[model samples]
Target: MYENYAQRLAVVYEATHKPEDFISADFEFKKMMRAGSCSAEDLRCYGILHHQMACYCIDKAVDLFDKVIGQGKAVDKDVFWRTKHQKMILYSQTGKAQKNIDEALAVINDGSEDAEDWICLIAAYSYSGDAAKAYEWILKAIPKFPDKAALYVYGGDTCRDLKKYDEAFKYWRKALELDDKMYDARYSMGFCYEELEEYGKAYDIWLDIARDLEEDGYEIEKQFPMELAEKCKAVLTDHPA
Candidate 1:
């Protein structure tokens, strides 16, 4: 069945969110889909494949998610709730605060308690220019799921965006403590240092992140840390710091 191909694509997606990987997955998915074998599972994978930073991808993902939501009883209860949750996340990326909040509220009540729900709800508030609410919720969430490194990374993001650099630093440090391999939190810390004009500190963190990425088998040449490291090095070379 086409669901088999869709399952394979889902595995690849979980492994890496690289656009190239999605392109490769799309090839197989299309072959199966065009054969008149498309299933609800295939549709879900298709939606996930297009969920990225591109504007077109966001619109397409939302449409696909909406279609999947309309499937109602055809989908499992849990899968249906997760689908709604994902749609809420994509809506937050649309840059509409009220709409994002409404979608977020709907999904949380749709019955699937997950760490992702808390983080996405926090993100909805943060990206919607309501960092105060995001901050309030993060404080509440950490005590409940203290070891969720992803939550801390998102909390760091909210603090950084609010110009609370020190609080952001605390959040990132806690995140790294929980998951030493959390390069996202490390990058956030590096960005904060750069924002504070601490070129030397930023340079060191960037170099560390580059090494971490390489250790994780990522190509440093294609990674953002190396790019940041190069830029920070140039700043240090000129300023002697």
Candidate 2:
């Protein structure tokens, strides 16, 4: 029966990238678990499917996460960490910011303090409206992951959140220096320029971002660049260079 359902799941996977497709897969996995036929690998896949489903059905996602956690050491440690991380992110999105922050800190205390844990700490603090703590964690994270462009981008974001436009530009510029294709850093740099009234520079940066996103075939992600480009174009029209 599991083999038959697995074959059906392969067909569903090939046929759709839609979240609702996971509903059937989840049902099959639960049936296999009831029959005591599910493996650790199967539970890991179920957890990932739940994570995807969580984007649209968060309550069910949380329930599935709990089921994954109940598997204890049966679930791979990395998979367990990812499930907890997903829950933290979901909590933040659902306005349980403090809970997310507490859980993230607890995870750090439990000795999983890797680069991602630091990044999650920064995000949890930022979401909870504690910019100082967020900035501090970003600083700590930079030394740990010096080659990571995203960390510098997060640093720039923290600076921007605090209205430190010049500092934000410096951090974003550093991120771009590390990886020229860091689109979020480039976009934030343009935003910093706009805040500083450097309209021409902002326009140029945003135009380049739009071109880059289009060339990269990022259909959904291109909207951000396109909207920013239009805003910059409007500013340039108002104050021509």
Candidate 3:
């Protein structure tokens, strides 16, 4: 029975790599595992599925991750590390900043200092209000993952947190240079301009963001950029050139 379910899971995994498709598969896998006949490979596959599902269904993702971790040495080392990394990211998203930081550092200490690990470390440190540390780590990580736009965005965020708006702008500008479609960098640049009292520049950036979000059909994200654009417009109105 478990073998049949495992084969079905493999079919689902191969059919579509989309996250939404995996959510129902993850639920089925969990139910099958509860029947106590799953193989190590079955659990490993389930862990991978759950990790991908984290973007849409966080609580179930965490539970599946915990189940995988509880398997201990039965799980492959690479799979375990991947699970830990995903768990660290989940912790960050769920407001467990300190846990995110600690888990990311632990993964690094365990000799997994890949790009994902560095990115997670930067985010965890920034979220924990240790922007200085996040900046330091970003610098260290740049030489390794020089082309990753997210690292530069984190650098910008740390600089902004320190109130160094000019420096933040430079970092975010570099990030946009690497990935022109990186709206987060554009949004951060707008924030830097706002902090520097450059209302016109900030307004233009937010206006672009609002338009982009609307065009992309990102309804929730569209609201923030629209609000920021309006606020910047109000500022511009108050102080005309």
User: Candidate 1 — which residues are off by over 4 angstroms?
Assistant: 1-58, 64-90, 93-95, 107-113, 220-222
**For each candidate, what is the lDDT?**
0.78, 0.78, 0.79
Tens-digit lDDT track for model 1 on 1-241? 4248666865686577666777777887788788988778777777766664265467768888888879873667567756866776666666566787766667677954666667767877876788899888888778878889988998899999889888899989989999897878988888899999998999899888888778778884437888898998898899894
Error of 1 at 111 (Å): 7.7
Q: Tell me each candidate's TM-score.
A: 0.64, 0.63, 0.62
lDDT of 2 by residue, 1-241 (tens): 5445743673474367465677677778778889998777677667766665665577768899988767874568768766866776777778899987887788778977477777778778877778889998888788878887877888998999899877888889889999999988987888888888887788788778878888898767777767877887787788787
Candidate 1 positional error at 43, Å: 36
Better of 1 and 2 by TM-score: 1
For candidate 1, the per-residue lDDT at 77 reads: 59
Instruction: List where candidate 3 sits over 4 angstroms from the true fold.
Output: 1-96
**Candidate 2 at residue 10, lDDT?**
35
Clashes of 2: 0
Candidate 3 structure quality by residue, lDDT tens digits, 93-147: 6888798888778977898757767887887887677899998898899898888
